[model samples]
Target: MTLNRQWLLKARPHGMIGPDNFEYTETPIPQIGDGEVLVKNQYLSFDPTQRNWMVDRPGYLPPVGIGEVMRAGSVAEVVESKHPDFKPGEQVQTTGCWQDFAVVAPGQGPMGVNKLPPGVSPEMMLSILGITGMTAYFGLLDHGQPEDGETVLVSGAAGATGSVVGQIAKLKGCRTIGIAGGEKKCAWLTDVAKFDGAIDYKSEDVSERIGALCPNKWDIFFDNVAGPILEAALNHLNLYSRVVMCGGIANYNNIEPVPGPNNLMNIVTNRGRMQGFIILDYLPRAMEAIEALVGWVSAGDIVYEVDIQEGFDNIPSTLQRLYTGENFGKQLLRI
Candidate 1:
């Protein structure tokens, strides 16, 4: 506990990320300044967007500098506080990075620092009620603007964000169809998450399945996996449909830039709208999403999965799960 163990970005990734992309070392536990707090990260969040953050390019946030701690979201316990609003032993969520300890302050970093609500576990705060949940809530309801009886399609539908998107669409009286990787995930989507139908993109013809599933065409496409899947969804857009661009995990590891969907004209022809969003833009109104999500989850209307990998040694390898389809849901590392 005297030193902070960290995974630093060693080199920018070329294709798929691996252990070599990061360097591990120990440093003195960071000291907190006045109005800052020192937190011991208990869990680390692994996200597809982290791949984008690793590249040396302009993004919503700055890339992790070489030899610097790799940035990540985490649920942590306050170990020491120089800030008046925080106290020791309280659990909070913040941009704790890939380190055992971090110095954080209120209204700092992309996530900033917020206390976990009463009766909310760290896992719940990081997964269903965290970034992914918020993304699903705002992306589908706010951006997609789904209506009753509309056919709602979701890509990456078994992942943290997409699963919730489909469920919320269902709650809003939309017919939900999910596109996931394998039979296992697709089954979970239809059987457990209660989607109207599911398309296993790995085994089935996605465009054909969409046609079968949405006989009337889809009204909203909440896309998390863009690439060929995006093109497929675009092919089946209903008139004046909405496409919520959330994540593009399909091409995140590509060495060369992947081509955009060739069928984007479908949007224009159908008079549809496609909009991309960054969850950070809605952070100020986070509680709005959290409140609604908590109600659904408590009432069993929404169900989410979290894949927790243990031990600090497994940190780098655990992240590879997101791109490799090894993770079933929200990927987190227990420190």
Candidate 2:
């Protein structure tokens, strides 16, 4: 009897996504005929891949087809149910897309989200427990593997994954240096996240500041914003250093391809290892990450910074903020 509002892709965006690229419509609520439970979405996640995946080309994941709901992962409360495993009032995580409601099957999605434990809010689940958290945990632990006394450099350090990556490095006894867009973000990174040092990319010479921050050379780099930042980090990479390339927000909106990194010579000189990572591969370790992440959150060792935008209709604008480096931290939608 209810209508579900879903944002469908209208046209593919070449550089940056905008409101015009989507078509929002009110459609009949999907019938939960068998094992499916209908959910009223409470929160949704916005990510950079929405841009990366829509190029009509093949990559690690498939592109979002025209007329399909703009793809997103969401946490919602079950409003109606036909499945015994999921009852009304229960919360779950599913591929909800940019919609006000969804009907998801049991034993589906990254993991069943029928119930969430206490102390983990919907924001925490979608962020720390979802893609952003996994990106930080797997990207740093698996690739960076920063050691005690090491100098760790994290680009986009004031945002979601970079904040956690720097904090995790700090917890492991490494000196964390952050690169963010402004002085405010830089201050938050050092003061709140406990990063040993930071660089405001807007006001300072990133490469020079990094050199001054750590004369020892950066031993591990968790790079979220690539392009020039990646180039800058290369100048300070230590011998056998590791670079975890998570996303390249700077180049996401470029009409032309970002020039090949200008500092490849440093990689050859330092014998550093540059690599890319995706959180999907680390799903099995979700519980392990939650246990550790929760401990940090409760102990005040880890801070969760979320930039929440209200309503499903605002998703496009919210998404554009990620590419502009305008969002201060973890980005999400409050449905």
Candidate 3:
């Protein structure tokens, strides 16, 4: 393609982000500089955190400036290379944003360009072995510090990261309970993901369900949906429990700051620890998660889902699916 089609940030969101937040444009396919590689994006990744990046504020990464390509992660093919480490036709993962082509270099961008490991497909690299998977591996193991025989609770349990977290906890011999939004997801958590129990937050009373399902209380709460759910989980924590503050998708689209869990004192009383982390902090140790995840997935111990939407025209609408919980797993767009 001679022109690079892109979705540029048109306006900051007030509530839920939608098509109006972006403007479509075409530009010359980006040229690579010396020591850089030019890549054609094949797939785009959509994450709730992208909402945080749209606002003009301080964050782990800078906000995507207005009229700039909307920041995103992508699996791309090396179309031309000026760098020695990459060559034409090799598939790679990089911060390709929402454009048809990008100029990338090793050690540049949040996710510095990396060739996909041999035998790993773009789906695998962007899902179970990508940022979401790495987040689950490190967030649960490093922050949650779960022990065998413990009872683990996961919020947003049907999502790409939370689902993997619960499965890993099960592999470690923990009895896992997942809190999701609908019956279908709840059923998938128990039937497919093999959690000990599932809570449908939309159809059931979350606090009461937690009390019933986790009669022994929980040792670790891997929370992705923070808000009322966090408050509910706090009601049933074992002594010295851990709360892995992963993402707060429940409030990501709020125009104003949502109130935090009113029962944070529960952490103090139970001698529990609640900690938050950005996956970028663990990028240096990414292969540690990747290697282990590959083993588990190959052995059938771990399973992940990717909800892919097609067409460049669907890009903005595809992102809207995340906030509305229309996506079943990892949200991706195939161009």
Model 3, C-alpha of 5: deviation from truth (Å): 0.4
**Against the true structure, what is each candidate's TM-score?**
0.99, 0.96, 0.99
Which segments of model 3 are wrong by more than 4 Å? none
lDDT (10s digit) by residue, model 1, range 1-335:
57899999999999999999999999998778899999999999999999999999999999888888999999999999999999999999999999999999998899889999999999999999999999999999999998999999999999999999999999999999999999899999999999999999999999999999999999999999999999999989999999999999999999999999999898899999999999999998999999999999999999999999999889999999999999999999999
Instruction: List clash counts for every candidate, in order.
Output: 0, 1, 0
Candidate 3 lands at a TM-score of: 0.99
- Off by more than 4 A, model 1: none
Per-candidate alpha-carbon RMSD to the true structure: 0.7, 1.5, 0.7
Candidate 3 colliding pairs, count: 0
lDDT of 2 by residue, 134-209 (tens): 7898899989987899999999898888899999998999999999988789889878888999899999998899
